[model samples]
Target chain A: MAKMHVKMTVNGKAVEALAEPRTLLIHFLREELNLTGPHIGCDTSHCGACTVDLDGKSVKSCTLFVGQANGAEITTIEGIANADGSLHVLQEMFREHHGLQCGFCTPGMIVRARRLLAENPDPTEAEVRFGISGNLCRCTGYQNIVKAILAAAATLNAEKEAAQ
Target chain B: MIPAPFEYHRPASLAEATGLLAELGEDAHVLAGGHSLIPMMKLRLAAPEHLIDLQDIAELKGIARTDGEGGGEIVIGAMTTQHELIASDELARAVPLIREAALQIADPQVRYLGTIGGNVANGDPGNDMPGLMQCLDAAFELDGPNGRRRVAAREFYRSAYVTAREDGEILSRIRIPLPAPGHGFAYEKLKRKIGDYATAAAAVLLTVSGGRCGSASVALTNLADTPVFAADAGAALAGSDLGAAAVDAAVAAALAAIDPAADNRGPVAFKQHVAGVMLRRAIARATERATERAAEQTV
Candidate 1:
């Protein structure tokens, strides 16, 4: 198979690369772009470690090919930080709440949590658990992970009210 | 696990896609969402020499009602994502069971990229849509060298990973006839955890009038080689109030139709029991909703 020229916006930057049709998006991001924030816990779609926001929706990057992501705007954990280099609200909550233990699933969990908050800014504990159900954290036992997401949601909502 | 190398084609039109499929021959596969296909490719279960992606075709997108009059059928483009289905207000109003079943498919991420066409057209017994489509009596619209054709959802599945779809034909749209006004519907699934395939699931749609069932349809998922339409089970509820005796008869008929294989979920006997349980739950919910609708109409 010939290499296909793929161009897309990644982490708010334009990126163009030549990739084979079979190259998974996770590999393309981690290898070609060196955006290793997204981990590959399971090459299969079962593990949400490769989760990323693509065109306003969270999708498993490992299951999609680069050719399929062509022309779409994508965001990984690297893009989750503040533009001024401060930690994102979700990241801060994760840190404060000890949402992670080994940190292998943190990136994907945080990324997915960010989207969950975006979609439902004020979620209950059960809703938060259901929202991040795709992203697993074996180390944290999910107790603090759910707490972190709920805390971030409340903080974000407060910030929005203050700004208004 | 990396997939084998294959030529990729993103056709701009349905004609081009079918032409590519015809020219590429039997070794080609249509790529839509690729939640199922890509995984199979990586596992080496499917190694198509040519991959024709249907994402670029404009005609294979969007959800709209057919132009026919009198509660026109809801036609969803095959490429519409499962997330889209869950969010569609039209689908919720026309066929709320779709939203119910789609929400139970996988978690948020997989739902974002998985397409309804891929789920139903592939004839994966584990997929939720095929059985729900059967319950709704939906039709799949196919486009190919022979032009357009529609196949009833119940008749489309031949076996696991096999369907009535021809090699050159592409499932372009899914047409669901509008359920009668105030009809009740539900999809009950029993799974080990979130994002897991159903151990056994049931979809039921029915209309109740004056505390009796006017009509009913029942279908089961992951309990057979193909999604099973329990016609006899559905018939058992018609003209009855869905009392304990009628519900038991329906559950028995549904359990009889299921041919579950022992897998990680459970043994055959356990699956059979679970299938009956799912059916009874689905029937009860449908009956309750129908009764509510009937009460509201009187008000």
Candidate 2:
């Protein structure tokens, strides 16, 4: 198999790499780009540990090949922080709400939650759970994880209102 | 697991895609949203030598209403995602059953990338769209080296992972004739979890007038090797009042049509029982909506 030239924007940076068409996007992001924020849990697209925002959609990176992601813009958990390197509201809420126990699913959960909040800034409890249904968190039992997302949504909405 | 290495081609147009498919022949596979194919690739169950990604093809990507013989039909580009289907208010208003079934598919992340074309074209019995499409009597448009052709959804599926689609052909679009105005619709799916496939499901569309069923279409999903279009079931409720007896008869007809092999979901008896329950619920809900639609129209 021949390696294909892949070019894409990840975490606001232009990236170009040569990868085999069989190289999964999760491997490309973690290996070629050194962006390991996205974890590969199930590798079968069942676990959302590989979730990332690709072209405004939350997609599992493990299921996508480098060839499929070529020329697409992507955001991983590393891109969720503010420009000054401060914690994102979701990250803060996760800590305050005890959203994680083992933290293995945190990166994917927060990355997915970021997109969920972006799509629906003021999601209800059920909406938050439904929005992040793809991402699994075995340690948290999703009780506090849901709470953290709802809290993050409230905080984000307040910030927007304050700026307005 | 990593997929076997394959050559990738992103075609800018449908012509180029079809050309590549014709050239590559059986060694090539068309990539839609890739939710289905990618997993198969990773599992090594399907190892085509060439992958033709259709994402760049602008032609296969929208929802539009076109004038046709019986009222108008909604033409959906095959690349349209499940998320797009749920987001299209026009589709929701025209063929709400689609949105209803699309929502019951995979979870949010999977739905974001799962294409309607991949769902129906794959001929997976577990997929909800095939039966729903059959209930709506949709047409699948296929393009290949020979020419473009249309296959009715009712006649498309031959078995699991097999369909009316031929080699070097791509399902370009789905054309669903708009249901009669104010027709009742419901897609009842029973699944163990959010992302799991349906154990047994039902799609129902019917119109009620003067407290009697006017026209009805019923289809079941995950009940057989192919999505079963319960023609006898639909016929069973055509003129009845949609009363208990009529629904029971329809359920019986639907149960008779399905040959469900026991799997993780349940044994044959349990599946049949659930299928009957799902059909009964779908018919009742559809009838209620039909009656409500009729009342609203009279107002």
Q: Which runs of model 1 end up more than 4 angstroms from their true locations?
A: B66-71
**DockQ of every model listed?**
0.87, 0.88
TM-score of 2: 0.99
- Write one digit per residue (lDDT tens) for candidate 2, span B1-299: 98888999999999999999999889999999898899998889999999999999889999998777758999999999999999999999998889888988989999998999999999999999999999999999999999999999999999998999999899999999999989999999999988999999999999999999999999999999999999999999999989889998899999999999899999999999999989989998999898998899999
* A1-164: candidate 1 lDDT, tens digit per residue: 78999999999999998999999999999999999999999888887999999999898999999999999999999998998999999999999999889999998998898888888889889888888888877787899989888888889999999999
**TM-score, per-candidate, Cα-based:** 0.98, 0.99
| Model 1 Cα lDDT, one tens digit per residue, B1-299 | 99999888899999999999889899999999898999999999999988998988989888896646776789899999998998899889878999999989889899988999999988899999999999999999999889999999999999998899988999999999889989998999999999999999999999998888999999999999999999999999999888999999999889888899999999999999999888888988998898898888889
Report fnat for all candidates as fractions from 0 to 1.
0.87, 0.87
Cα deviation of B267, candidate 1, in Å: 1.0
Candidate with the greatest TM-score versus the true structure: 2
Write down the worst ten-residue block by lDDT for model 1 chain B: B63-72
